[model samples]
Target: MADELVFSVEGPTATAARQISLAEAGFTERAHLQEWIIQNPQVLGEGVLIVTFEFDRWRNATGTAERDRLDVLGIDRNGTLVVAELKRGAAPDTVEMQAIKYAAMASRFSVQLLAEAHSSYLSRSGASVSADQALELLRTHTGYTVDNATFRRPRIVLVAESYPPIVTATAVWLGEMGVPVNLVRVQAYELVGTAEPTRLVSVSQLYPVPEVESFMVGPRSRGDSEQDVGPELPEIEWSESDYAKLRALPPKPTVQAILDLCSASPDTAIGLRVIEAAAGRTVFGARGELAGLTMLVKGRFKRRNWPFSVEWGATNGVNQAHYRMSAEQAERWISSAGNLEESPTSRLRSQEINDFGSPVSPAPHKESGVTPQ
Candidate 1:
């Protein structure tokens, strides 16, 4: 694989930093890589909860320990168990088969078993989360029951610097055969004149390129497979109970501002700069952090299926992703989250949200020139 480049900007000058191997950079699979993923699991998927790492609780029919430890195990917003295998460098050829075995073993876990493991993991991390509490946390974060028929199988995610051709081929074949597999590349780069530690770690999805597949016309029926993504997901309706849950959350000033801005124009997608200006600060984190916000909200009592949808497009030659809230949810969110009356959001009411590349609407957008993030 060709080495990737990371540039450092000093004033108007840009310096390209050479990409180094994991060993050269003093990183190991278990210590550095696994810990980063556990701390921030959005690298794999939005709203994925870390159940446990180095998991080897599986037992054979004879009650013998299987003695196999998966690197990291998590669950996404849809309650599908995520089996993520980590590698600091390029993955060996046998990695795919190894991940498949770990996934198969994890698929046998029930809601009870999964909660117990999560609780244990939490305790080890000095967080002391009980099994019952863990189960409730799972329900609130995912908004889907783990015991449902949909979570019968676990999904697979491979994280490495690079992968062999055979491994990528197997991943594609598995996806075609209805297996949910994601291949991610985690890059490590050292920048010049940054801080005490000038290292920069970036995670990106290699397979199933999302930026290319902006929209897909597909079936709407809910399927058992996690890979069955419909053309467009319906806006999640928030109930009184859901509103109460939102109110229970700690003061999220940024989220509150977003609700007010989107609620102002109802059914219109707003620019990130306008949202940021409304909030009076840079609200969302990097791409992974932004995914946790727009795609799925995750934290203590984080709400799943947030009514926000982010669409990527070009603005003045720069590509930016914008967030939108439907009219129904906009009204619901503002009322539930407390009323905040601001200036009307400057947005065009587009007829075609699916065809984002086309001109937004007949009406001009006052906020379009606000410079999206």
Candidate 2:
């Protein structure tokens, strides 16, 4: 409600607005803003609708009607079609209507048409991406699905400092009708008297408090609610007998079990291999087998981030001992016992004296002080 809301292709005049759009500060300083966004996406959350490379262009319409100019066309993460018209400076209320007209044009377009446009944009920018490749990459990077079954919605993003009250009210009302509308306010700020004021900022959707909260917090709460309440029953209680059963079983191949189940080749080697899921490529490296196996176990367990404890014991003639041990201690036992020739039975007994049947002591690692040229 402040009259200080002056839109510009520069920094915001208010501190609150600046923090919201800190990353999107400069708009007129060439097209660096778009590049900054694509690179450092952590600045914004996944819900962001990215519109890249906007320029004023007009295209003639086809058929019996007179030809008309199309305003803006953008592709969303799911490759959803977005047709928008940007209005800068003091524009007429009619600008919103014109944006709707552009959206209508975009709605008539086939997915192939949008795909071609995406490909062209990437190509002109010298990016090595084919049409299919671009779509695939965008799908993964943006977490937006672009299938025929997905509902396509038209978007109208009004980039201005302020909108008329009617426009604001209309956008909200249309939003209820399934139309996606975003009124982004671009404002300018100058640091006076020793304040560095060369920055440009954009405060997107400053007004409409409830809508902002719904956009940020609503999705997360819904997801949390839908999540399983977790096991209704309490955890299993193990006694000394249970510990003896595991100790007697011996350390079996965890990773190898997965590989065998998946029918993966046994010759795949046991060293470190960085497997890329999308590319289906694995980079291999060699180190002590014991160390690599231990790291793999630690990495998998860390992902759980669960709150629980596990312990190990030794199985001897008629006597079974089990005690609680920390995660670190269990891993150490496995490393020591898992060797080329060591059998599970021998390792189990050795570990009882060595500690809860962990692997083995790893070789000491030295810090490499050498620098590469």
What would the per-residue lDDT of candidate 2 be over residues 172-254, giving only the tens digit for each residue?
77787778776666555543333466554544553334535444532345555332333222233333343334334433343
Compose the digit string of candidate 1's lDDT tens values, residues 189-208: 87766667577777889996
Candidate 2 lowest-lDDT run of ten: 270-279
lDDT of 1: 0.66
Model 2's lDDT to the true fold?
0.39
Give candidate 2 misplaced runs (Cα > 4 Å).
1-72, 76-79, 141-144, 148-151, 195-197, 211-373
* Top candidate (TM-score): 1
* Candidate 2's TM-score: 0.45
lDDT of each: 0.66, 0.39
Q: Which regions of candidate 1 are displaced past 4 Å?
A: 1-4, 192-197, 211-373
